[model samples]
Target: MTKRTALVSGAGIAGVTLAYWLTRGGWQTTLVERAGDLRSSGNPVDVRGPALSVAERMGILPELRAVATHAKAIRVLDSTGRSVARIPMSSRNGDIEVLRGDLARVLWSAGRDDAELLLDDTITDLRQDPDGADVTFERAAPRRFDLVVGADGLHSTVRRIVFGPEREFSEYLGLYVATVQLGGAPAEPDEVVLLNVPGRLLALHPARGEAGAAFIFRHPEIPGLERGDAGRQKQVITASYQGIGWRVPELLDRLEAADDLYFDAVSRISLDSWSRGRVVLLGDAASCVSLLGDGSTLAMAGADRLAAALAETPADLGAALRRYESGHRRLTGPKHRHIHRAAGLLVPASRFGLAARNNIARYVLGR
Candidate 1:
């Protein structure tokens, strides 16, 4: 019997994990990433629950632990930078919080030798028939694969081509988030200091040796905010955070100087089905719970489940896809439903709600 071939788009958490598991399951895996290499910058992410098991199985748990952020607490601050409340970062279930780039690097190192990697390339078109899908790449030669997986995140090319345009499935949560690296160490290196005013929040998270600033604010979608236009995005951030107290002005200055800025809307993706014919979606492309939810954990767990389902029924691709979607939906559905609650806690819409959240964090959660 010929070994099945799989092509996975996006070399992030979901794509790498799926590639690792698929190769381990006797499938020939090809991983394609648009960037030249694994990205070295992103916000921190968590590895907990089922994802921990996946990491342990892959033997990358020790590396993840070594690079863990180990943030002592989340210190909430007033507009003037005075400490208002502190929520300890304690996890009873052995959750590990690591920088997103660190986790991706570790996963990539673990899977790079197992599969063929196509860097600096992307699929431009895909035509799927009963047996396989013909793929056209921007730089690589055309090829056919037994299956295609879109782990390409919120703005997935595969999902756009296979399912529909992103606007058809995306649900914007009335918020935008941007992260930029700071030049110096945080004042409170052991804690993630957060300052919020009504619908806006600025957080400084310390990791490794440096710190990164996060800007999250509630705003109606800015018309004509192209994803590739960093200058316009910075202008929007500047206008939104203009005259705000605290270290926002300094952070904006850093944002202006910083070459790497990650910005996007806090949006969710809703789809009636995760798979169509020989093509399937994973991670944020399938069901995005936004930054407020445990997206990294879900992505890893979903990838493992998907690889297992494919291995279980190699001959019946449809059944395997159904099994993967059915089982993984159990994990992602609740996250999608409760995202608003998480958003409310993270970025409150009103002063009253913000005050209540702080009180809850101080009096209830802080303890």
Candidate 2:
């Protein structure tokens, strides 16, 4: 029997994983990424619960474990760089966390033998028919696929092309995060230090083995800041905690010198259903709970579910899409809101909220 063709958008963890599994299931897989090549960012990520099961199935669990960050346990602190509370992560069961770069590499390397990866290209225009969808790429000729999946992430182009404008479903979770990598090494031992102030949280996470440094700062909201301009986004974030304390001054100096920075308003993607006809969504493109723990894991789990569904029902694309959406959404949808609410308390709207949170941590949540 002739195999069906599947097209996946975005190259981040979700898209690539889907392409990987679809290939194994005897389907022709093509992944188109907007970026010229694999970014392989070194952001820290975790693989928890059944996510490990999927990795095991992918046969890369051993390699992923080898590259796991074994990040130092999380430390919560006060404004003056003083430790206030701590969470022992080693206590969690069956949890494996690794840098985002490692996972991306693992997924990419795993799929290299089975899937067709299209880098430096994008699906700029799409048209669907009763039999299939016709996609026009920015760099390639038009093509038809039995199905299209959006693994493009929160600002999913596939979602926009198939669903609608992004703003309709993505609600800002009342905070923004500015993350950057500094080139110069600090003259001190690297550690994760979190310092909280009213309506903001500043954190310094030293990169593994002194490769570089990572800084994260959070604020409730920035009303008029232009989100599209990268330079301006960096400026607004730097101004948010202009005089935070201790190493902050030196850190900002390093940030200005740094060229590559990652910044985004912490937000979640909410959709009633991931499928609209033959086109479906996955990962952050479907339900992004930005920067929250386990969200990406959920994305990976969704990829496995999606590929399995397609494998089981390749002859009927409609049945396959419905099955994938039903099973996967049941597991992931509600968690989106839970993450949003928790983030709100983590970085409150005012001084009162901040104090209340610290008090709760010191009294109620403390062990």
Candidate 3:
């Protein structure tokens, strides 16, 4: 019998893990990524719950633990740079916190040999029929696959082509987040130092022998802000954080010179359906819960579930896709509903709210 063929877009956590599991399930999987190589820069992400089991099943859990950040505490500071609260980090059932890049690299190393990897290429158009989907790429010739999965990201090209425009599915959460690598190590190597004002937050997270700075602030959606225009993004960030204190001026100066900065609105994706014909969406492309959501964890677990569903009914692609969507929604739906609560906790909207959060941290959580 001929094996099933699958095409997965995006080489992030979801894409790579799906490719690995699909190959092991006796499918021919082609993983396509726009980048020339795996991306090595992103904020720290968690790999816990079902994702941990997924990693163990793939035999990469040990490497993930080896590269874990192991942050000891969260040190909160006021605008004056005075430490207001210190919340100790506690592991929940052996959960590990690793840099997003490190987790991606580890997953890629484990899965790279299992599937055909197409680098520096992306899907330009997708046309699906009852039997298979015909895909056109930027650099590669058109090909047909029994299944096509869009695990791209929040602003997924595949999602745009297959579903519709991004704005229709995306819900802007009144906040934006940016992260950049700093030039020096953190003052406290084992702690995450965060400075919070009313509607903004600046954090220095120490990881992998260095520190990365994160800026998150509440703002209305900026009109005409394109993803490729870093200069404009920097300008907006500078404007939002202007006159802010506690190492922000220095950080903004660094941002002006930093070329590896990652910036995007902290938004969530909500879709009525995750599949259209033979094309299916996974991870952030389908339902993104943004920062507070265990996006990485859900991505890994969702991919595992998707691959298993496909294997269960290889001859019935529609049933498999439906099963994947139904099962995965159970994992992501609650996070989507409760995202506002988490956002308020992370970035309070008013000075009163900020003070309340700090007091809760110092008293309730700090203990």
Candidate 4:
């Protein structure tokens, strides 16, 4: 019997996690990434729920837990730097949060031992047939695989090749965020300081005594802000938040000089289906929850399900793809809705709106 082969696009969290699982199930897997190596500078993200169980099954549970950031505080604040509330961190609560770069490194380190990873390459065209997919590459030679999976991110190249344009499914969440590593520390220790003004919020996530700040601001659909013009994007963000209270002016000054910037709208990807023929979508490529929700957790969960389904159906690749989509959609659909709903509840359009949210948070949740 010929060994089954699979191709996974993008080497980020989803692609690497799926590759690791497929190799364990006796499938020969190859991964292609646009980046020369793992881009390990992403911000900290969370991995929770059944996803943790999936990691434990791979025997990397203890390793991930050991490197957990141990984030002990989430502080909500006003424009004057007054504290609103602070949420505590504990393993007993069941959420494991770590830096996105760190978690991707962990997954890749484990998966690379079992899979063939082609760095600095990407799939340019995908033509699927009955038995296999003929994949065209940008640099390397074309290859065929029994199955292809898009574990890439929101701007997934694989998704465009297999599916149509992104605008058809992406729903803008009415906000934009900019994140980058900085040389500053938070005003307080272990504090997740979030300063909220009208239609905008800037947060500082305390990490190992230093801090990484994230800026989220509301807008009315500004186009062409993402044309690889980091300076222009910074200008637009700065102009939008001009004269706003809080430490935003200082934050903007710091952001302007920052070399590494990740900026995008807070949008979610919703698709009627995540699988077609032998081509399937996983993680942010399939379902993205932007900056407001537990998208990282969902991505890990989706990757686990996709890999498990493929492994369970070692012989029937098509059935495996279908099962993966159904299983994952079931797990993420509710949480997706909850997050979008909570977005409006969290990001206020006015001072009264912000106050209402705080009152609810203080009285209802009593945080």
List the candidate 1 regions with Cα displacement exceeding 4 Å: 224-228
Writing each residue's lDDT as its tens digit, candidate 1 over 34-63 gives 999888566888899999999999999999
> TM-score of model 1 relative to the true fold?
0.98
Q: Rate the local accuracy (lDDT) of all candidates.
A: 0.90, 0.76, 0.90, 0.79
* Candidate 2 RMSD to the real structure: 2.4
Candidate 2, position 296, lDDT: 59
Cα RMSD (angstroms) for every candidate in the order listed = 1.2, 2.4, 1.2, 1.8
lDDT of 4 by residue, 88-114 (tens): 555554667777887888888777778
| Candidate 3 residue pairs in backbone clash | none
Off by over 4 Å in 4: 364-367
Better of 3 and 4 by lDDT: 3
Query: What's the lDDT of the predicted structure labeled candidate 2?
Result: 0.76
- Weakest lDDT window of 10 consecutive positions for candidate 4: 86-95
Q: Estimate each model's TM-score.
A: 0.98, 0.92, 0.97, 0.94
- Give the TM-score comparing model 4 with the true structure, all chains together: 0.94
Point out where model 3 deviates above 4 Å.
Answer: 224-228
Better of 1 and 2 by TM-score: 1
